[model samples]
Structures are given as C-alpha cells and as structure tokens.
Target chain A: MKFHYPNGKPYVPKANSVAPQLKKYKNQVYSNRGMTLEEDLNETNSYYLERKIAIIHKKPTPVQIVNVDYPKRSAAVIKEAYFKQASTTDYNGIYKGKYIDFEAKETKFSTSFPLKNFHLHQIQHMEDILKHHGICFVILRFSKLEEVYLLEAKHLLAFWARMEEGGRKSITKEEIEELGHHIPLGLQPRIDYIKVIDYLYNLS
Target chain B: MKFHYPNGKPYVPKANSVAPQLKKYKNQVYSNRGMTLEEDLNETNSYYLERKIAIIHKKPTPVQIVNVDYPKRSAAVIKEAYFKQASTTDYNGIYKGKYIDFEAKETKFSTSFPLKNFHLHQIQHMEDILKHHGICFVILRFSKLEEVYLLEAKHLLAFWARMEEGGRKSITKEEIEELGHHIPLGLQPRIDYIKVIDYLYNLS
Candidate 1:
C-alpha cells in the first residue's frame, strides 16, 4: 500500500523505484538487517526502554481525522481522514536528565540529502528545542551506502541558512561526514543513536 | 460529531450528557473561560512556545491505519483506521534544561479523581521517565469545582501501589489537595502548571 501527505506528495510506498521513498527497504542489506530507519529506531527505543537506558519513541504519524463511524460493539472506524504534516520532529524523549528530540530520514541517493525532505515548521521546532537547551538532532540514513549519521540540529540550521542565502538546497555526503557523528549499525539496538549522544554530550 | 475509542467507548461528543466524556464542558464556568482542559493547555503551551519559556507538546492521537485510497492528483485519503491506545504520557518536553513529562486529565467528579482515568502502561512510562531523572507528573482538573492540581508522578505511583493492595480506586479531593500543588487558572497561560513546577523544583 502507498500513503501520501495531505499536500499530495507520496509518503511511503510498499515498494519504490524512486530515491526518497521511506519504505525502500527491499534491498539486500536492509532485508538482512531490518526494514526502514523507523523500524530500526523502534527496535532501538524498545531496547533502551527495557534496559532502562533511555526513554525515546517515534511520534505517531499525525492525521487529520475528518469523519468516524461508531459501529456497534467493535472498534471505532475512521471513515475519512487526511495525513497531517507533523509540526515537530519524529522522535523525542528523556535521556539522562536531558530532553532529546530528533527526526529520522533515509535516502537512496548516495551523495546528497535534499533539503526538501524537511518542512519549515520542523526546522523552526528544532530551533525552539535548541533555544530551550534540549538535545536536538537528525538521523540521516544513506540506504544505498548502508551508512547512518547523527547530525546535530545546529548543522542543519546552518545548512538551512545557507540555502536561504542562495546556496545549494542539499547537504553533500562530504559535508555530512565532516559535521555529523557516524552511528554504526548494531544487532541488538539496531541504530545506536544514544551512543552518539553519549559521545557527543560526554555522558560516557 | 461524536468519536469513539477502539474499545467503543465515546471519546469526544459534540455535546455529552453523561459523565466521563472528554467533551463534557458545556457548563457556564467552562463556557466563560475555555471549553476544555485540552484547549487551555494548548493555549498555555502556545504561550510558552512564543516566549521560548519551554518546549512542550501534546503528542498526537495514535491511530492504526488499515487502508488508504490514493486518488489521482489528490491527497491520499485514510479509508479505514482505528484509534490505538497511547503507550506513553500525553505531554513531554524540555523545561529549563530539564526533561519534563506529564499527562493531563479532567473529571466531572468533584469528590475524587478516578485512577482508571490512567492506564497501567502510562504509569510504567512515567516510572521509566522518573528513573531517567525526568520531571514527571499528572495535571488533574476538577471541572465542577473549577480547580486544577499538579500531582507528581511519585504520589500517583504511591496511590497506585495502595490500589494494587486493595485500597480505594480513586484519589479523594482532600488527598489531592494535600499532596498536589494547586494550579490557578488565568488568562494567556491558562493552566500555569509551570509556576507550580518552578516552585516545587526550585527553578524559581
């Protein structure tokens, strides 16, 4: 099945030949490990939760429910609804007395991550979180290269500012490699983002 | 329009005549102020957000989408879906470099606040947050009395422990008043729960 944003953009497809589809996980490495970045993060959060290490969770996809049916004795069926763009990042929680906030995005493109993947409101949200002293970041997954990196929200804001100043609308692989912390994929927690947080924040 | 939970219990009614309905706010005091606790909190959060005082948000309602219809050149329509029980608290974020988490609930009952207003999973979530050193609590509103209280998660946990040992299923108004900080309602930042937080946590 395919899902789309209310703005008429495709959200996720069961299978996609395109570069930006979130569910483009039918590849060999992804199939061997898990599916999408979302699945990995969910697994990682569950692991963290069970071990009492951290308490992170992906916010549910926001939907604008228009109509619902109260069928007798069964579940209430949402008859008509539209996907609403999230005002904040995808994932957030508490880790070691600090608030954590982040968004996860994956691209099949091997060289660059387009700025179009994020909305303006999300950028504003990250800015607000940073001002409030929350640990804020973005998890960028290059699916084709089988590499993931944790980029602090500040770097993204810088790139956004550059874009606004008539620079390129995407952050290149080299730039990301320089500014972002590489998150090595693991078995138990899958995407060990908190490890990056620990190293960056000197928690360990 | 009326919406029901997946369990077939009424979620929100345009006008509810019975108790326990989340939308039972058609009274004079409520109409003079805001309609519901949710509206007030949302307004308060907005006030905080605008001033960069805190970075808090109410998590979106979770839904299990079973089917979608993607019409050509139009937004994808959720054809079938059901509400899912949230496994975490309703609200969480950062406050003055500390992680903050809480659930807000209002009851028509003037004598006591029902423990069943919360689920066990939410309690577990709060426990996890508190163990991680996050500031966690519950915001309770007594609609008939036009009063609000911020009960720390620790107190609620103790109450839950007593309930598990076959104690009363509800926290009496006296008990809540004794243990919880009263949140005086006002204009702009309506609930002003953060004032109670600053006082309790010595942030003031």
Candidate 2:
C-alpha cells in the first residue's frame, strides 16, 4: 500500500537522493515526494503551527562543526563536521497550553516494532518527560502497511523495563493496536496527529 | 566578575573544542569550561534534566548538508554544508505541565541589547507561542556586566511592534531591568532561570 501525500503523490524517496530535507521539501516541490515518517510528521506539525493549533518542531540533527570557511558575502560553508546523537525525542512543543513531546519512527517489520527503533537515552528522556508531566508518546508507523499509531510513552517505558528482564525485544502489533491511537493517513496535513492528541489529551 | 560553573570553575571553552557538545560535557568536565552563556544554559538544562526539574534544550544550528565523505567506517564526515537561517527560537521544552520556550542571546554592549540579534521570524514565532499560551521569553545577558534577565515575550513583542513605527532599535539596560525578571548569576545551574519563571508565570 503506497501512502500518498494528500496530493495523491506516492511517498517514495527519490532515487540517488542527495539533498537537504527541508530545501527538498520547499525550493523543489515534488522533488522529493517520497516522504519519510519524519517528513510526513513535519508537514502535519507545520499544519498545526500554521493554524495556531500547536507549536511543535523537529529538532535539527546536532552536528559537531569542526571547520567553518567564511567565503566573503556568502553563507558560511561547513568544511568538516560529524553527526552527534540526539538527547531527547525528536518532536516537542506546546499544544493547548500543555507541553507535548513525542518521537515519530517507522519500522519495516509487520509483526512488531523493534525496541532498537529507539536509543536507550531516548527512552530515558521520555521517562523524564512523563515525570515532568509533559504529554509524551511515540508515533510508530508500520511502513509496510502504511499504518501509524500514537503510543503513550508510559507504555513504551513499561515494555522497555521488561526488556531488561529478558522480555520480548519488540512490542507486538496487537499490543500496539490495543495501547495506541490510530492516526489516519491523510492528504493536506499529511498525518492528522493533533486530532489524535485532542482525543488522547481530552482537549476541546 | 567571571561567571563560574557551580563547581567553582570559571566557565571557559575547553582547550580543544572539536568534540561534540554533550559528549565533551560528560566525558571532559571542567574541559569545555571556557564557556559562553549558551554552554552554561546547556549545563543548567542538563542539571534540570537530571533532576527532572524541566525539559529544556538548545536547538542545534541548522545546516544544509550537501556532500558527505565516507572515508572511514567510524562516522560519515559532512564535507560540504551551508548554514541555514533558523526560523524559531533557540531553546524550548516543558516544565510543570506547561510549555516553556525561550531564546538566549548575549551581547557585549553595555547599555542596550540589539533587536538584530533576533530575526523577524523569531519575533513572530514568539507571538505565536504567546497566542498558544506557552511561556515565552528571551534571556538577555549583558556579557560585560555578567547580568542576565528573562524578559517576557509580550514585552519584546511590544518593542518589536514599535520598531516598525521608528521606535528605539534596542532595549535599554534600564528597560530590561525594569520589565524583565532578573535571573541571579549562580554557580550551580548557572542561569537559575526556573526561579525567574516561577515569579513571572505565577507558578507555585
């Protein structure tokens, strides 16, 4: 099942991909229509932002800039740098006066979402978010089925803790279906996550 | 007066600044000590994170990666990238079940903090944050004076609107002192902004 970006364009990564994510979305429309779960969420978040429904954004991937070359009157060129691991969940912001935090990920496996989809630090960060009273969850997309679910972080944490005791290394799809909210695949806003949030958080 | 990390060390950039920030901060303590307000904020955030006090983090500078060199297996090296303008505030997170967003900027000017330190989109972003009921502010540090203030977004927005009408281009120290909540310079949690937030937001 091919997921379509409201525009009916199939979500497929362009072959020989080599372009910055945002620019590919903007400067060149239809240039990179094969949207990743991250990209789809970005679009949905943008929708929420534009309508003043929410204020969430994906944090830029951290990079250790080693050498920057200032070439007169132009943007600074980063000559050398390396990707740094992120400390927290990817998407976070304010929604209806509440701190909303979550991470979106896609998995190829249809049976279960692997625990490896998240880093240990990310799980800890979500635990911290829960402790801080923020709304925390994971948007798990089964890429093969084009199915997405928003599972509260508490559930993820529970499973993660059990893993330490030799529990299943992944959360079965049935468990996800029972514990998570289904996010209908859509067009304009791409992924209608806020609607699920409104229901989940009991927001008007 | 030099601002010191709570552990009684003047915050200075560690001699060799090539390592990634979080790793450097963790592995080489007092190492990255020659620090800027940004680094101090990061440490303070880490402190808050550890204690589960607040969930704030500085956004990484956005860069557009164009070319990468996979010379070795260890890590992919970003060879060509350009700095991209950020469209939002630098730091944001959640605290006490509320959305908290802020930007920290330091200027050497003794009398005023320049408006140019922020881009137009950022000001608009703050306005949106306010509309959404998020706690939004700017951390202005008079580097020379070693004084910091958490100025509410409303105040900044007021001056920004006036700027278009040919008002003062900067906020005077007197103004910041009067309208902003002064954040005590401290050794632990250097900025100690949560105290200021408590007062400004009327949180118990």
Candidate 3:
C-alpha cells in the first residue's frame, strides 16, 4: 500500500520486515502474525473495551475537506481534501476514573528512536495532560526486536528538552529500556499496555 | 455551505438565525456574533485552552478516505472519502483531574429537544465513561430562544430510557430548564459551560 505525508511526499517505512541478520530467540514466540504496532494496539483496545477494562480509542485521522460532490442518489463523495497535522496524541480515553492519552510509534532501528517521530504540538499536549493530572505516555515498539515499551510522558519531555538544547536528536535504546516498562505480547490483549499502566499508577 | 451526514443525506440546521419574532430581552446581551453552537464552542474551547483554565477540545470530523491522488511537488489530495458516524461524543478532555466527555447540539424548537439527536453508540460510550467515573454531560442550545443549558448525562440516560419505553421522543423544555444548568453567554468565553461543570462536579 502506498502512503503519503500531508505535504504529498511519499512516506517510506524505515523497515517493514525483521532484519535477516538479527538473531531470534526460539523460546519467545512471535504470535503477532506480523501485525503493526497500531494494529496490535487497536486489538488490545478492543479487548479492553469488550471486557469493560478500559474505554480507550484511537482518534480518527484528521482531514481538511476542500470540496464535496453530492450525487442524486449515491452518498456524497469528497472530491478534494488534505491531511492535517494532529494537535494531540492519537489515543485517549478514561481508564479507572483517570484520563489516558498517548501516541504510538514503531522504529526499526535498534540503537535509538528518532525524536522526529513526534511533533512539538503533541509534546505540548502531553504537558497539558500532565498539568491536568491525566495519565499520559507513549507506546514505543522496536519492530526489529519485537519489543514494546511504555514510557511515561515526563521522560519523553525530558528527552525532547535535551534535544532542543542541542543534545542528541534521538532517545537511545539504553535510555528507553532503562526508563520504560516492557509490555509482553499476549494473545488476548496483544500488547497488554494497560498492565504497565496499572503497575506504574498503582491502579491494580 | 452544505453539510452531509455519514449516510450522504443533506443535514439542515434547525435554525440558522434566531427567530426575529421572539421577544427580545433588553437586559440580556447576545455577544456571540451570530455564530453557530459549534463555532461558539470552538471559540470557547480555544479561550479555555489559552487561559490555562482547562484542556478541552472538539474531536475532528471523522472521514474514511477511499482514494488519494499524489501530484508531484504538491500536497496529496483526497479524491474520494466518506464521513464516518462518530461512535463517541464530540468533545472530551481532562479538566481539574477529571475526564470530561459531552456532546453539543442546537435545536430550533423551544418546547423540546429531540432525543434522536443522539445515537446508541454514543449513549453506550457515555455509560462507559460514567462507569469509569468520568464527568459526562451534554450542552444543548435552544436556537430559537437563544438559551443554552448544560444537561447531565444521567438525566439524558433517564430520558433515553423513557423514550425506549415508548415515552416522548424528546426532552421537554420545561424538564431541561428544571434539570439542566443554564449556561449564560459571555463575551470572553461565549458559552461558559465550564462554569456549569465546575458547579455540577464541584471542581471549583
């Protein structure tokens, strides 16, 4: 499938498949069926919703509709539109009486996660969420390693500050692994991110 | 401007302008500049956001893109798309450590607001929100009367139940006035619904 950024530039994923040179642990089962991080999270959210565990949802992609054509009988068709940059994170909802908000991203590089994956407005949104005592975090997936981590927004903000101060432009894998909580892949809830949230917030 | 629903049916506002036939109250000021309920809410949300008083936002209109055309050196334009019926409320955010969720609607009838304005999925969404203890409600506008009220979600649920039991398909103006909190229009905030929430939830 072809993808394009809002600016019309063709978007190419860093890596779509696991690197052939990487070693695989036989004991760790890869049951994801090659699902993307977003697909896994969507499945997890659906599980949570069905079981009454949480009410989280991914916001729909924003678009700027410039023109629309309404046929005589058929549905109205958008003739012209453009993608718009999101002002907030992708996922948000209420969990255990707390507001939850986060963005998800997958990186093929095992060494670091690029800071460019996030927009500045999203960082500002996280700050606002934090000020309001909402549960704000990010779900980072190392696609090549089949590893996922839940990192608190404060840590991301700290790294973003460092980047703004002329430091490294990416969060090193070591920093993410040390500061973030690992979420084991599961069958029912795919990523089991809520478990990490439970442990972090003492909601369990 | 023309608006179409997810089903492609043309959507007509109940009343675009306040009925000039209604008696004018000399003491009251209508400072909204003839903006629709949505525009006023957007302006109010912006005001709240800028003032650091709250972090509320209107969710973008959901659209499903079917086709996109990428022209070299220009923005990718959506060629075909359809609106998606929202499965959740229109507005949601965190305010004073609480999850706020609500839908805003305007009606021309001064006697009652039709319950058909809501969908089953949205009611279910509100129920989930309530189960999670998030603050939930609806902002209703009687366009002909130029009156706005913040009605609690529980009240709406009760009215919905009554409708399901073959009761009136609408909530009477008398009932709303008695049960809902009146949101006085103001210059800075346009519709001060947050104040109503502060009073309803005792956040202030």
Residue ranges of candidate 3 with Cα displaced over 4 Å: A1-35, B1-35
Clashes of each: 0, 11, 0
Q: What order do candidates take by TM-score, descending?
A: 2, 1, 3
Fnat per candidate, as a fraction, reads 0.71, 0.71, 0.63
On residues A19-45, what C-alpha lDDT tens digit does candidate 2 reach at each position?
Answer: 655454333432332247767887788
Candidate 2 residue lDDT tens string, B1-204: 222333345445234233564454333432322247877898798778768788898888888877667665678888888787787898999888888999888888999998878777688789989989999999999888888889999999887766655677788999998999888878888889998888777885
Q: lDDT of model 3 at residue B61?
A: 81
Query: Among all windows of ten consecutive residues in candidate 1 chain A, which has the lowest summed lDDT?
Result: A13-22
Candidate 1: CAPRI quality band: acceptable
**Candidate 1 lDDT tens digits, A1-204:** 122232436444223122332233234224533247877888899888878899998898898777677778997888878888888998999888889999988887899998878877788889889988899999999988989999999999898877766678899999999999898899988989898899999997
Off by over 4 Å in 2: A1-35, B1-35
DockQ of 2: 0.37
Worst 10 residues of 2 chain A by lDDT: A1-10
Residue A121, model 2: lDDT of 64
Q: What order do candidates take by lDDT, descending?
A: 1, 3, 2
